[model samples]
Target: MSNQATPWSSAMPEAQFQLMHDILAAPSPIGLEAAMTEGVLRPHFERIAPDGWGVKTFKGHAGIVLDTHPGRDDLFTVMVIGHADKIRMQVRSIGSDGKVWINSDSFLPTTLLGHEVSIFSEAPEAPGEYRRLDGGTVEALGAIHFADPKLRAGEKGVRKEQLYVELQIHGSDKKKQVEALGIRPGDSIIMNRPIRHGFSPDTFYGAYLDNGLGCFVAAEAARLVAEAEGARNIRMLFAAATYEEIGRFGSRVLVGEMRPDAIIGVDVNHDYVAAPGIGEKRMAPVEMGKGFTMSVGAIVSEQLNRRIETVAKDKGIPMQRDVVGADTGTDGMAGVLGNVDCAATSVGMPIRNMHTISESGCTRDVLACTHAVAETLLAMDAEESQTGALHEAFCSQHPRLDQARPMGHQGLPESD
Candidate 1:
């Protein structure tokens, strides 16, 4: 019911759409994010980034940062991170019947049932080399006829411990047969779904859209900043980070090493307006195809948020405010977790069915976020040109509560 035109109908370039598709299609599940960070994101940055831009890699993880104006002490440094990791299941144990038991970390058991998946096993002989096995479907208590009365009546909930992958192995020594194929404990498993346009205009749905959309936006925004005219007074670091699903460990490492003056964690937020059974949850009414989301609470920097809001207003970009309570729930918390002194905030596109095979998002919101981030960087660059101390200026701009004047109301008297 949105008025926005679909990407097919709009002016979105073919190459951009293709890049988005490729990023989402790349399997970079949690601990195995090198597939995306190295294969997909690094290539895209190398191709489009300007001559002065250089890519930096972490020793501890697969996280990569594209840096513009590196090692400039005079300039403010801002890191815009989009996690390249997706939640995944890990091979826990294999049974003699050829059933692959998986630890469904971060995924509800109900969501995994009946969904096709691909398990990636690192060849023990080759160390880092991975072998992917397809044609497996997640299953639990296979048939309704075999289900107990409580399960049939939905009185019992499915638990992750009971789930196993149906690989349909035939013949004796099934466990050895699986092992011969390079499958083992601690291998990664992910949904075998590809990103596709949705029935609605400007919408996309697929597995791993949770954070792929984030990386895509960060890449696009970096491209925009690189192409823009003017001498940048601030160094922009666009990072495709890894291990966000596990505990944001990769981003924490990146921030601790880079030590940027500001950080913007670009990730996905739930489209609470369209969420089922979300009554009285007090969640923001963020919806797909509306605009990008800006985090307001938690460890978010008010001055940085205000700057982004000003930039969005000036550029005519649409955005929604998201209230994140204890944490932003994205890489936005990376700086805080690492005890780094930096201004941090989160920006995201509203998504539906996060952590599921069919996560949904709006292309329009993605594009809007890209523009908003790009413009905010440009705006800060412009500010630095005039102020000559962008970081110090931002630090000094925090709102002073004592300076705020009290307003009179019908029931309350005005302050003197």
Candidate 2:
């Protein structure tokens, strides 16, 4: 292994930024991630992992999965999964008064009060089948348009009916136009927010940074692993999944299908600004720009965690460890729980304002995570993995007699 970091490390910032922009620009709510994945992510993986490496798209019950596994069987596969969907709203009903009622999906409706939104519609042009429309915006409603003085105090919850999506017309005439556009009651609504860069080029803020950064990291890691020659013992699958905001629907499907020996979930970790309750036992800082955060807890594999930590240290990648007392609330945990038992752990990108507009993070931190993931894959030994054997040095010095048993044996015999 080279002592220096690969040139791929420097390329990650630009890659991360570009992917983040594309994903944020697409109107992909939880159940409406098809356009984003099929339009943006699939093409990216095809371009990056070329040479007949076609991107695989799998449709599921409530979501979609884009598979980017380079066909290599030199070793067991490590699946890198990321959720592509963000929390948004769904069209409920179009009122006769020209305003459309929307049901917020998994997020506060007040956060979307004044923001612009795009309602995806499939409207066909002349002599053509229905095509996707340019999308519309949020109507001037909610607390902003409250005519009653008592209701303008912002003390009450924004009811689903209080918020409205504007189709740009009024009354029955507007309803007819919206129907002509092919937008229905079940159509998705996306926040119309643009990604913004901070004072430094490496830092930026935008909506849906929760898992956008994760998709970027997984994409870059897949590209690096596919392009590198020394990773003969490492197989990788990059899964950009959907419907993560509400549940792990896509990830559960991915685990059952891929059944990889190990699954690494790349997603956002709540920074202090986003989740002040998260703290290390030693009071170690887990702030933005610090580095990648690895979840350590019940669902995480001890062997995988140890190997990843060793790889990150050897590669000089900055990383932080955080404890998750129960579930990590990530796709990796979903895989561990739903699929056959295997190695599972999650690496989180520190993000602020998660699930809200203006969620942000540092590109440098993303790069660190991308590098750590690639290095860890390269460091895994297929022999140890397939044999299901831990290193002698890694074994506990004082193995508990009660917990020790022969392979395939459930309990000690009465003779013993």
Candidate 3:
């Protein structure tokens, strides 16, 4: 057990809440996460890991490695991962009506209609501009005309298509003027909404809540561990990875580089909720405000999961168990599959309306997850972490990992 109080067990609730608000205020839509990463996450990380820890950024994927060993060349490392990127759409073109074209791998065109959006440009300096776009009714196209009314065409639900956005301005000349302001094709677009508060003292709502909440929890956990003194033998890594909504692109790069003894991918998990057509697909037995979740999936290491559960129970932190069949659809699977030796599992904050702008969760659950993670990391021993019995068991279940590609062969660029 760790001598240090589970850092963030007390004052961290408000801190995590504020951090979540700040992260949500910034517009971080998918590939355009440079602002969230370089602008927001970097400064916050520097503040938390100011001493000997080496902070590095790779293509907007930022990480801080805490070297408890200091000058020692060899040290055991455990990584906590969270994606900095959120799902968003890209600008396809500028319509003649001074409107913008929209396309996304994740949202239906109808769902975006009438919703406010923030357009992100390459502006590494000032963030993007916000505008409201009308999602015209099914009977008629709104301010921006769609080539096909089919944009809203599903009898049962909204049909997804390439959509369009209209600014308050109009005409081709006005469109050119708007483009001149640095808004151009290929920029990213995301739903815009102010943070909603007081659904109850414990709950709140906002956009990008899916994984941003995870990042906030991880940051709080890191703050506690960095400030503690007794953690001298086990090195810890805090990875704010990007581009997880589309795929595990950022995490694959990070896990290959860090190659930690164990990795915990922090992300949002869904609980019981009803959706059209899909019915209760969004429902889980877990509840927000109740606690964090330990996901069971193909990539989750049973031993690592048991360790986390033990920590949570011993510390009296509330927690729940969830199961996802083949893939958990989070970075935990990516890290585990890519680095066979590293033990991997996922810790989730129960969230509602995942992937939509108005995602919501309980602040109490966020703090609980932070406390659980901090306690788990603090309790880990270097010698015990390096053992790969779980990895051996996983390999036995899937023989092709050895035949198709051997372990310890994949290499990543050296960390800066």
> How close is every model to the real structure, measured as TM-score?
0.94, 0.80, 0.78
**What lDDT tens digits, residue by residue, belong to model 1 across residues 126-239?**
997888889999998889998899989999988889899999998999899888888888999999999887888667798998898899988988888878953367888999
Q: Determine which window of 10 residues in candidate 3 has minimal summed lDDT.
A: 131-140
- Tens digit of per-residue lDDT, candidate 3, span 173-195: 97776677666777767777746
Q: How close is candidate 1 to the true structure, as a TM-score?
A: 0.94
Off by over 4 Å in 2: 1-16, 50-54, 59-74, 123-136, 139-154, 170-174, 273-284, 381-416
Residue by residue across 340-400, what tens digits does model 2's lDDT show? 6567899978877777777888776787888889778766644445554433323432235
Candidate 3 or 2, higher lDDT: 2
Ranking by TM-score: 1, 2, 3
**Candidate 2: worst-modelled 10 consecutive residues by lDDT:** 390-399
Model 1 clash tally?
0
Tell me how far the alpha carbon of residue 382 in candidate 2 is from the true structure, in angstroms, after superposition.
7.9
User: Which residue pairs show backbone clashes in model 3?
Assistant: 113-135, 114-134, 114-135, 271-284, 272-283, 272-284
Clashes of each: 0, 1, 6
Model 1 misplacement above 4 A: 1-11, 409-416
